[model samples]
Target: MLSYNSLSLYLQVVINLTLLTGLILLVRNGIKTMEVIMLFLSGEFALELTDLVDRLLKLNTLNTYNYALSQFLGLVMLTEIYSRYFLKVPAFVKWIIYGYAMIFLVINIMDIYHRAPVTFYSNIISSIIICSFAAAYCVKILQKGKVEKSLFIVNTFVFLFFLLNA
Candidate 1:
């Protein structure tokens, strides 16, 4: 007796998980920085894992909190990893990013548990964050002079879908 909405969301989760996995495998043979890219890919996979968990089970307040926190953490880690491809960020900056995201994650967990709504505009705000990361990923592809056109388009498209659904 699955509802259409939940089924659709789960399907999207599966789709994203597949794409991320494929991209990770495609880049696995690249030299030098392949290991780092693989690490971020695994981080991306974590999002799918949490999304599946939230969608399959009866989600309570704690479950919702964890779901949001997973998205928050996943975006932060993936973006920080991606920033390496675009910007010449310092090592200290990475630590700072992790620290800031952890702080926000804790606050968000509390907010979700307390039924305190988010202050950062809306869920659309997180969508914007994802879009921005996708942009950064595009820049990396461009810098490398690779034809990552499909990846770029699909990333933006998927982010927009989530944004609208949010």
Candidate 2:
């Protein structure tokens, strides 16, 4: 029987592999959003691999920092993707997103500087922001009355992923 840590490591490896495969496929297809998505996936894949190595090396401090960085980048990348998904993203809304990301980054940096444990509040906030983006995308699709199967599928998964995380 696998220990809990071993099982978790295996799962992480599997997820990393899946993300890599998706990145490759997205690149080959030359989708309009390919660059943003590929960047997101690549960054996440690198961070996750770093996390795995940190864990194996028993570097708890580095793992915590990695997690914080991953959450911050994920927030930015997902926001960018959602902003581009809409034909008309409001200027004020974009400013709000930018402000929120800045605040989050500041909080993380402060925590790291003080050698404080990172807080879950940032994760919760990030999840809420992403879920809202997903909801807006859904509303946009409804208003357009034309569903692109691929987008719908991606939107559904994103919403579910964030919802569960929240």
Candidate 3:
């Protein structure tokens, strides 16, 4: 019988593969904003794939720093994705977003390497920012009052995922 972790890992693999297939189909539709999201998902898939291998080989330490890297990269790409696709942030806002991302990455790395106690700050900040952006997107669509059914479903799923995770 497979353990819970094994089941979860297999489930994640299936989800990632589905995402990859969806991305491929979306690429053919020529939605340029999805390119960043596609890249992020691809990176996420690679990380999870390596994690599956690590579990099989008992090489846990091989992914010690990878979680932090993936989180930071996700934050960075989500910022770009939201700014470009959902909201048109001003230039200065973009600068601040990038600056915060850099600081978040640096603090995350330092905390990991130095065993600093302030590591959670980066995680909290990133979560809050991303959640806020997701909320803003939801609000914007709601105000429009004519969102397509497919978009509404997708938006709800994305918002709920971040909200629950955050």
Candidate 4:
């Protein structure tokens, strides 16, 4: 029987493969949002693959950095997705997103310099931010009473995933 750690690694690999396949299909079909999703998936897959390799090789040095970087990138990508989805959102909302991103970056940099493991805080903050964006999108859809089926599906999944993870 596989150990828990081994099983999780296998699961991650499966997920990465699935994401890669979906990304390829999206690219081929030339979806308008393909570029954003493509970049996000590509970064995520690369980071995940690196992490898997690092674990298998037992090179544990960069694990914290890898995790932190992945979380940061995930937040940025999700923000971009939501910003595009809610194009009519107020100017202040965009400013808030920008401000939060800057603060997050500063926190990550300070943590790295001080050799502090800050993934927990970063993860929580990012999750909340992402969930907020997803929720806002959902509200907008409801108010409009017309849904972009694809975006609604994506937003729903993102909201649930981040909410649970948070």
Candidate 5:
């Protein structure tokens, strides 16, 4: 009788863990940093871990840790991939990362105080935004057949949960 979101979150974590293990292996294998492999692996690991914490604690069903992590981690992985594949951006991207982290920090404080359903639901909304941007970037890369090695594992993690109900 669990909600679909919870069900998906659980499956996503499992897939993400699997992807993270693969990323760790790739990191050990070579290819250095920011390879297609590295970006994907890092994203998968950070994202999945964030979701796992939310699940384990049963906090903020909508505005969960996973939700917050999705935005932050998306920025991290995208930066890695873009920096590797495209132009080197301004150093401000680091501050951008910090910005997202700060927002998450606030959300955590709110979690302790309010524990509102809105907090958990906010995760769903943020995740949707993250997913949309990711999908667009993924499509651009997929078209070129030039995805980061890590992306394949990340894709597996994302897809596995979305289809788990089947």
Candidate 6:
């Protein structure tokens, strides 16, 4: 019989694989925005798979590396998706987001080398930034007086959940 932790890991693998399949299908048939979102989901799936492998192999420190890489890439992808799809922000704002993402990526890379422990700081920073982006998107949609109710509601709740879970 599988232990609880092993069962959880197996469940996560299954969920991520399902999400990966849906994302792949959406990317094949959807718009440009779907491409960015697909990349984000793909990264997530890859990291989860890495986690499963690490668990099965009893690897040393692979989770830290996988997590750091995922956080950085997730932030970059989220910035792109939010700026392009969720917000009607100016180009300068998008550039600023990209700049921040680049800086965060560098910090994470440094953390991967210098920090012996897991990069919780980088994860927290990325989570907060993503949550802020979702909040800002909601505010923008409200201000614009024509809300894409589904997008606004779904993304807002998702990011809030991300923040709390983070």
Alpha carbon lDDT at 14, candidate 4: 70
TM-score of each: 0.59, 0.76, 0.70, 0.73, 0.49, 0.67
lDDT of candidate 5? 0.57
lDDT at 73, model 4: 75
**Model 2, 48-130: lDDT tens per residue?**
88988988898978887787788778888887777776435677976887778778777876677554444567778788888
**Which candidate tops lDDT?**
2
- Per-residue error (Å), model 2, residue 118: 5.6
In model 6, what lDDT does residue 110 have? 65
lDDT of 1: 0.58
Better of 1 and 6 by TM-score: 6
Q: Write the per-residue lDDT of candidate 6 for residues 89-156, one digit (tens) a residue.
A: 67886677677667766666666556634366656766887898888877777788888644664475
Colliding residue pairs in candidate 4: none
Strongest candidate by TM-score: 2
Q: How do all the candidates rank in terms of TM-score, highest first?
A: 2, 4, 3, 6, 1, 5
Model 5 misplaced stretches (Cα beyond 4 Å): 1-16, 35-101, 142-166
- Those runs of model 3 whose alpha carbons end farther than 4 Å from true positions after fitting are 1-33, 55-61, 113-117, 148-154
RMSD of each: 5.0, 3.3, 4.0, 3.5, 5.9, 4.4
Clashes of each: 0, 0, 0, 0, 12, 0
What is the C-alpha local distance difference test score of candidate 2?
0.74
Note the residue pairs that clash in candidate 2: none
Q: For candidate 3, write residues 95-141 as lDDT tens digits.
A: 88788877766776666555434556666677788878878877888
- In candidate 1, position 68 carries an lDDT of 60
Model 1 TM-score relative to the real fold: 0.59
Per-residue accuracy of model 4 over 111-145 as CA lDDT, tens digit each: 76554446567678788888888877878877889
**Which prediction has more favorable TM-score, 3 or 6?**
3
